[model samples]
Target: MTGYRCEEFFGEGRRDAASVMAYETFVLENTDILDYLIKSDLIGETMKELLFVYKTLMKEGMLIHTGFDTDYEEMLYRYRNNEKDRVEFFEEVLDDIRKATGVNVRFCLWLCDSPQECLDSHNADQAKHLKEFEFDMYDTSDIVLADLGKKGKLCGYEKLPEASCSVQMENNL
Candidate 1:
């Protein structure tokens, strides 16, 4: 199994919401020096890494937000009653992501082996850790089972907290 490549939203404050936001604000404040640093060779290694991680997490968070909700049970309920088909759902997600992040990300809806597996991963128990921190949770209509990236090389997936094992078993039964 590919075991789904999952991106942990935060890491010991490295990618936490507050850190990301603060660093972003700092970057915006320092825009005058940003182009100079980039054009010149004065950019330090630490700054380079921070910028890379920030951009990566921001994009990943946006992708996850498009396909998930804060509350697991409510997310599942919406999934059960969703009226749009897969194409419609994914397309809507793609559009929203573009609008939110201003990045043109392409998604592959059938990259995963099964939709249920994707749901299980997205709502896995590990995601519950999110409740321990502070971040805005998206109200999603379905579990997004797609890989996010470029046109031919899509490669990102994520799982949030609070997945219900009983719900999985109940559905299986």
Candidate 2:
């Protein structure tokens, strides 16, 4: 998808907490960005990907401090109570996107690892998914980094050590 497409989603006015949570859930569920790597294509399948992205976003300072804990708790309750409707959840997400980004967003699910992998998947699938819809490709890892950097929070990454090693010999000495 084009940057314009992404811009459209973020152009919406301020979104409510429920809307934000729903949007995040939609991104988590529909995008093949994470599932493809974790489940379909036989790549890494750890929450590390999600955590990395979230941490990076937090570090980059692009994350809005919107008191999401209460929202999350409410959502979790609804989910656990079986009161959450999948279709409705997605609709709320779309609404949130419209409000937050001012542009309608769409997703094309694929089974691949990287942007290149997504392209390859699209080609292999005869572009069936792509033909049916227009969606912006989202790389969870990249998104995390970019969001964090966008918020000027990449210093968190900078604070992390390049490598961890122990000087056993020096300790003995």
Tell me the whole-model lDDT of each prediction, alpha carbons only: 0.31, 0.30
Q: Model 1 — which ten-residue stretch has the worst lDDT?
A: 148-157
What stretches of model 1 exceed 4 Å from their correct place? 1-84, 108-173
lDDT of 1 by residue, 1-173 (tens): 32222233222213222222233223332222223222333234554444344344333442244454434323323433443332243344344444544544342212223334443434446556443322222222122322222211122123222212221122221
User: How well is each residue in 18-128 modelled by candidate 2, as lDDT tens digits?
Assistant: 333334434333232222222322223244354244334434444334444444334433432343553355344334434544544332211122323323333334433
Give the Å error, residue 39, model 2: 25
Cand. 1 Cα-lDDT:
0.31
RMSD of each: 18.3, 19.8
Clashing pairs in 1: 123-163, 127-160, 127-161, 128-161, 128-162
Off by over 4 Å in 2: 1-74, 80-86, 110-173
Best by lDDT: 1
* Candidate 1 displacement at residue 87 in angstroms: 2.0
